[model samples]
Target chain A: MSHRSFVWLCLLPLAAVTVAFFLLPMARLVVTGAEGPQGLAGYLAILTEPRYRATLLNTVLLATATTIVTLIVATVAGMFLQRHRFPGRAILIAMLTFPLAFPGVVVGFMIILLAGRQGLIGDFSNRVLGEKLVFAYSIYGLFLGYLYFSIPRVILTIMAAVQKLDTGLEEAARSLGASPWAVQRDVVLPALAPAFVASGAIAFATAMGAFGTAFTLATNIDVLPMLIYTEFTLAANFSVSAALSVGLGIITWLILALARSFSGSAVAAAG
Target chain B: MSAQAGHGASVRIEACGKTFADGTRALEPATLEIARGETLVLLGPSGCGKTTMLRIIAGLELPDAGGRVLFDGKDMTAVPIERRNVGMVFQSYALFPNMSVSDNIGYGLKIRGVPEKERAARVAELVALTNISGLENRRIDQLSGGQRQRVALARAVAIRPGILLLDEPLTALDAALRDRLRGELNRLLRALGITTIYVTHDQSEAMELGDRVVVMQKGKIAQIGTPREIYFTPNSRFVAEFIGAANIVEAAIENGHLVLPGGRQPIDGDANISAAVAMIRPETIRVLAAESAPLSGVIDSVSFIGDRQRLVVSGVSNRSLTVDAPNTVRAKSGERIGLSISPDAVRLLPPER
Candidate 1:
């Protein structure tokens, strides 16, 4: 065969796998979304119905909050950990990243162990305040679980970026009469914008699509993933769940794209 | 320009030494003084602590306790780099990639809270001064290496700093660009007339730019003198070899003449010394007819350099002697030549430790 044909032959397996596993399933999901009595309006039901809209809003807000907080915590921690050398630093970093190996259900269980009704926080609060402050079964517990895993991913990327930072840039700033805070504001933070966008997108997408943590927390928690699971498995509402799934995917992708474009302009402006 | 004149601060570093946390001593306790509006070069090979001394002066790294840095007689030992108001240019240029050329140059002014209009005027003035006028709005990455160098220099000088420290500013560029920039930088420094400390390993750069050059070796200052002084009257073999090309001859002394294997070479030194280490600059030795001069050697190889021809002459001493002959003279390998060197041209150095 010619060179072009040989190149095409190499791509054949990837084409088969994508068509069989991804494209076909996606096309079926879209078609099945409109097979209900509401027809094409079944996709609109995700936005028009009060219950589905609230769950969608809750999921978006939780994911957004998780991403924002994770980025803040990780940037500070990563900068410190990457710059300073002290005893126990390696073990500290290893422990921080240990969450990456955990499944979402395990993260949820850990949160419950800390904040559940019979857990440590509740026990302490009951002894001190004469009240049991339990939040493990609520959306807060799922938020904590998402933060636990999201932090490790964001921190690792930030640390890598920090390691690659030209220390000369900071010194040059200082030589130019920039105080330490000014150096961070004017030099270090702007240089890390690209890493923030890349890692923050991963955190946001993970939080949006995660299900096992919400499932393990409580059935009543109104996140889109849990709503879709109940609507498909318990109520047997395949069309609605399929439409919700498509909506979730599109919204997460759109937000990430929006973030990328926004940071792109900022990076260019910085340059 | 008038305001900047005499604004240069005379720096006096008193016994500054640096020992790292790992117990590696980066610099020996060395004290030096730089006059106002003078350029002092710290020249040495890599890992020779030139950069460490520069950092000590820049306040980037603090010296050991009791090692004080003073600016114009005022002690500034505890002051940080930012508060010390010293301008610095790094080897990598370190131009902020996230900024435009004008913004990079004007960053110091902005940090000082210079108003927007004044900052813009200063940036534009520096843009014109550094010969990068049209590149003001362009990003740092858009500029070539030479342009980046000019921007880095402009940024360092924008704040009208009292002292300027440069650590191998031209080292990252190609050879041709480095030479061209060296002249340009020399002119810029003279124009500014600021107290400047430049660090570089290139001897030619140290010779051309420094009013005084401090030759360093193994974290200690080997010699500190003017270029001519360091070249003509080097205190030791290390300074002699590090600054420029030299042929070190080990010979016995008799009647104040160096008794070489080729012939007795006259030197200005104590006659009673039994042996001595002498340094003769390559250009100082002249090749003549073998029968006419006191010293004679056989030419092993002839290299025709553009300005002058270099001949590797054997049988002059224990080792070969590199002799620079005039380009107009035609001499081939295997020719016997006499070497004529003046007494004053031979510098008798103390024996190596």
Candidate 2:
């Protein structure tokens, strides 16, 4: 066979898998989205329907908030962990990253054990404030669960970045009369900008598309993933659910791209 | 230009010693004085404690207990580097990559809360002074190596520090660029007249740039003197070998003459010493016609080095003696040549510590 034909032969299996599993399914989903009563306007129904619009806004806001908070907390923790050496420091870092191995359902379950009705927080608050404080079925519970898993992913990237920082740069800044705060603000933070963008994008996109935690605590939460699940599985609204899935993926990807352009290398991190 | 930058401060380091946490000695107890506007260089091989001493003076590292650093009659040992007002240029340049060249140069001034217009004027002045006038708006990553070096120097001087500490500033460049920068740095230092402490392993750099050189070995100072004094009248064997190429011959001294295996060499030293070590710089030894001098040897090798020809002559001493003959001399390997060295040019040194 010719070289070009041989190369094509090598790519045949990969092309078959992509076409069968990915391209065909994606095309079917797109077509199914337009097959609703509103026709192609089913895509526009995502923006016009008040209930669906609210769920989309809620999901976006939660993801953005989680990303911003994750970056702040992780940057501080990562800097401290990378710069200092002490007994049990390695063990502490291992414990912080232990959540990386957890599924979102487990994270939500753990949050329930901490703050659910008839749980530890409810019992403690009942005694202290004479009330059973429960938030396990609310959006706040889902927020807490997202933060739990997002921290480990963001912290590792920030720590790796902090480890590669040049100590000479800090010393040079100090010799030029920069105080410690000034050194951190002007020198160290600017150098870590790329890491922040990359990790923050991952945290944001994960929060936007996450469904397991939302499903576990979906009693009161109206996040887009939970709304899509109800429409498809409970209400049997396949076309609307398909349209919503496409909308969720596009919005998450668009935000990630915007972030990447802003920070140049701010990109989505792996799971 | 130096008046605009500010006056240099007199610095004194008293009995400074450094011991790391692992109990290894990085620098031994030493005392030194640096006058205002004087350039002092610490020259030695790697791990010679030269950088440690510079760090102590710069307040980057504290000395052992009871040691103190003073500036202009004031004890400044307790001050930190940020408050000491010392300018430092590292071997890595360490320019801020996130900022433009002008921003990097103006950073210290901005930290001091200098007004925007005044800061720009000062940065402009430094850019011109360092010959990087057109690169102000460029990013640090976009700059060439030479340009980065100039930017580092300009940034360090922008703050008008009382003393300047440079750690192997040109050691990162190629040999040709290093030599060129050596002359340029000397002229710049002379023009600035700052109390500058320069650390380098290259002896030629020390000779060209320093008003005085401190020769160090291990964790202690071997000798401290002017470049000429250190080169010509080294107090110890280490100083003599570290400064320049010298043929060290071990011999017994009798009546101010060193008795070698193949020749009796006249030296300027005590006449009563039973045994001694003497140093003869290669350039000081003259290769002569075989009949003119008593000391004779067969040239093992002749290397033409453009400006001078170096001949390794055996049998003149127990070890081979190196002679730097002028390039014009027609000499080849395996030829017999007489070697002549003046008594004044031969320096007797104390045996190794």
- Fnat for each model: 0.90, 0.86
Per-residue lDDT of candidate 2, residues B1-353 (tens digit):
12234368989999999999889999999999888888999999999999999999999999999889999878998999999999999999999988999999999999999999999999999998999988999998899878888899999999999899999999999999888888888888888889999999999999988888999999898889899999999998888888889998888878777887667788764567788778899999987888887588899999999999999999888799999999999998998888889999888787676
What does the lDDT come to for candidate 2?
0.90
Clashing pairs in 2: A198-A267
Off-target runs (Cα >4 Å) in candidate 1 are: A262-271, B1-6
Who wins the DockQ comparison? 1
Taking the tens digit of each residue's C-alpha lDDT, what string does model 1 give over B52-152? 99999999999998799999999999999999999999999999999999899999999999999999999988888899979999998899999999999
TM-scores across all candidates? 0.96, 0.97
Residue B321, model 1: Cα distance from true site in angstroms:
1.7
Residue A221 CA displacement from its true place in model 1, Å = 1.3
Docking class of 2: high
lDDT of 2 by residue, A82-109 (tens): 9999999999999999999988889888
Off by over 4 Å in 2: A269-271, B1-6
